[model samples]
Target chain A: MEWDWDFAWSIMPTLLAGFRITLIATFLGAIVAAVLGLVFAILRRSSNRWLSRGTSFVVEFIRGTPLLVQLYFIFYVLPDLGLRLPALMAGVIGMGLHYATYAAEVYRGGIESVPRGQWEAARATNLTTRQTWLHVILPQAVPPMIPAMANYLLAMFKETPLLSAITVLELMNQAKSVANSSYRYVEPMTLVGVMFLIVSLLSVIALRWLERRYGRVSQ
Target chain B: MGDWAGYLTLILQGAWVTVKLTLMGSALALVVAFLAGLGRISHHAPIRWLSTAYIEFFRGTSIFVQLFWIYFVLPMTGAELTPMQAGVMALGLNVGAYGAEVVRGAILAVPRGQHEACIAVNLTRWQRLRHVILPQALPLMLPTFCNNAIELLKATSVVSLISLSDMTFQAQVVRSQTGSTLMPFVTILVLYFAMSSAISFGMRRIERRVTRGLDGVR
Candidate 1:
């Protein structure tokens, strides 16, 4: 099939709109991942055995399951339980929860890597628990987390196409719509793939820059 | 489909399929990935380039699109396979690419001192790799391989579109028959969640055992 610049040019506007949705979903999902990551991290380290094990169980369960199944659960199950999230909300929640399992691991690694002496010093100075966490441990642990976190962010961006299953008009959905209406999978699907590749590549490159920008954590 | 007991049995059936797909696909991927991974680190340039190209091509595309290409497009070109066959093939190839990276990385992680020792002892190439290198690499590779295994297991759900009667398909069946989307989906999600959590827990235990043995060596 011949490449048509005109069709590609015309589709850009639709894909751009889809790009906006993708960005929003990725950004929002990252927020949940960050907060929930901290929660999981703390829970996994808690002195209480049940809490830590339970949290670990949750993390493993979520990690092991496919995000697609999770999405289906959120979309199909919620409405029957007398609640209905917007399709986008469902998409974002599934992405957030699914990736939170991974982010928890990253957070756990970051937290565990904090020097034991730091905790000892915190107790020596008689800092409050909150102060110990906020002032000392997090500062040390979170810096190295930036690059890994950014990588997850990009991963989430690529996963937005999976959101189309729930009827979210993300880039792939738009491409599918165009393809279905016009019967041209050749151009639309290829374009969608190319667009995703370019954006994700840029995201990865930017993340590499962030790693260099915050090398203290790793170095 | 809506009867709780009947729904239970159907999901159990689906769970069986999910297990089969996950195990079979992972086993195939492990074999292919090991070879490609070895090729990637081979002495020859062509082997290296071919492995690299394979990895990059598969990794660059989304697995969903790839599944569609193999399942939907291949039939039109006169190469016909069942949805289950195509699904397994796609999953195997896709996961193989990522596994190759893990395999290569794990091999490289083997200590350089060991490599030098092997050379000093005049061990054959295969002897050094098989006896010394792979043993060390295997344990280090366990944690990452477990991670990929879980990821690939979860991905087996993508095969539902080609009409494989996996857990996802069973959930769809219940959803269609009962119109009670929530119950069926929630049940299936929990089913998947349970299976994955069990596997991961087992993996962690294995990793601990492997690491303990490594510590003993030191």
Candidate 2:
């Protein structure tokens, strides 16, 4: 019932191990979100009406649903349909796809902020569509996006706790297991909360630096 | 396939609970948002610091950990709470922190001329805030508040972990009873989307009414 420093020190190793897994899942998930979000943004802007509308609908549907349920579906239901992924893989993908919808909105804003003249200039230079996107548009668009993208990365990190639901040994799961076995809820749970708070505050500082370095997207 | 009506009825009952939690959580969040937001801009330094600390603490931690700490740890300290109470507190406080920022931003966005006019008219601080400031800022807060409400709804799904028998929990129950994983999840997903869209639609209507004359400047 009281604060126990010795007990907290005893569980430090296990919690740190769980913290590593949490970091790994978040890192990989950010990569997946960044790439897939770009795809969603580009697809929604396609010339074909069906493609654009369908892409937007899918993005909205994903955005609307809860990521916890999505993770349950991916980890439990998909295996029934002959797709079985490792628990970590399922967790990372669920986090990535859920956040991709948000990141897509950020990317759309960044891409749109590039002036119409840039597209015209690319065409004037006789560049192909692919060349224009690669050489001219994205370079200008991606820099301003770094700060917003980093914000989602930190959000995804905070969400890693949900991975515990699907049996990934992330920080929350580790803390829960420690509490369950040792019958000491206070230290483990408090440690988990403090660890998360520290990391998130640090990331906010880093995000501010990123915004200053890369320049923020004007909303 | 078996007893389709029974399954639908059970899920609807759970959906009702989800709706209740969302409504209760949002009401609590709105209260916290206003208090903290106003506190952040207060002239008193201690009040401002305390508000900033509350906002940062809630915003910095994951909602899951907060829920666990409230549900599990509090009982140990002899402050027991029902699952519903715990879920509402966690959801409200978490989203309320984010909403406080929105409230602060909207208040700051109100034109300086309005505040000057209040000073010229010799309005007290309370009068200035109630009659002059809030009416203008309320319109700007509506759209962002709608988003926060939807986020709170999505977050209610996390309460299923604590055996609250909410929509997501009932979906899990349905999955076990019917041996069908996909249908229950898909159904709940659609239900969540409908709820979110409904909130957006209702907020837009309110937004239009509130901003009826203000659109000229905004």
Cα lDDT tens digits for candidate 1, B1-218? 42799987888898899898888888888997898999999999999999988886677667776776676556656788888788888888988988999899889988899999999999999999998998889887788788778778888888886688899989898888888787777788788877777777888998877677577664
With candidate 2 superimposed using the best TM-score fit, by how many Å does residue B5's alpha carbon deviate from the native?
2.0
Worst 10 residues of 1 chain A by lDDT: A210-219
Q: What share of the true interface contacts does candidate 2 keep?
A: 0.82
Q: What are the per-residue Cα lDDT tens digits for candidate 1 across A1-219?
A: 456789878888987898789889889999988888878887898999999999988886777678988899888887878788999999988998888877888888788889999999999999999999999999998888888888777777767778888899987788778877876555666677677777766776787799888663431
**Residue B198, candidate 2: how far off, in angstroms?**
0.8
lDDT of 1 at B93: 90
**In each prediction, how many residue pairs overlap at the backbone (N, C-alpha, C within less than 3 A)?**
1, 0
Deviation (Å) of B215 in candidate 1: 5.6
* Model 1 stretches astray by more than 4 angstroms: A1-10, A46-50, A213-219, B73-78, B201-216
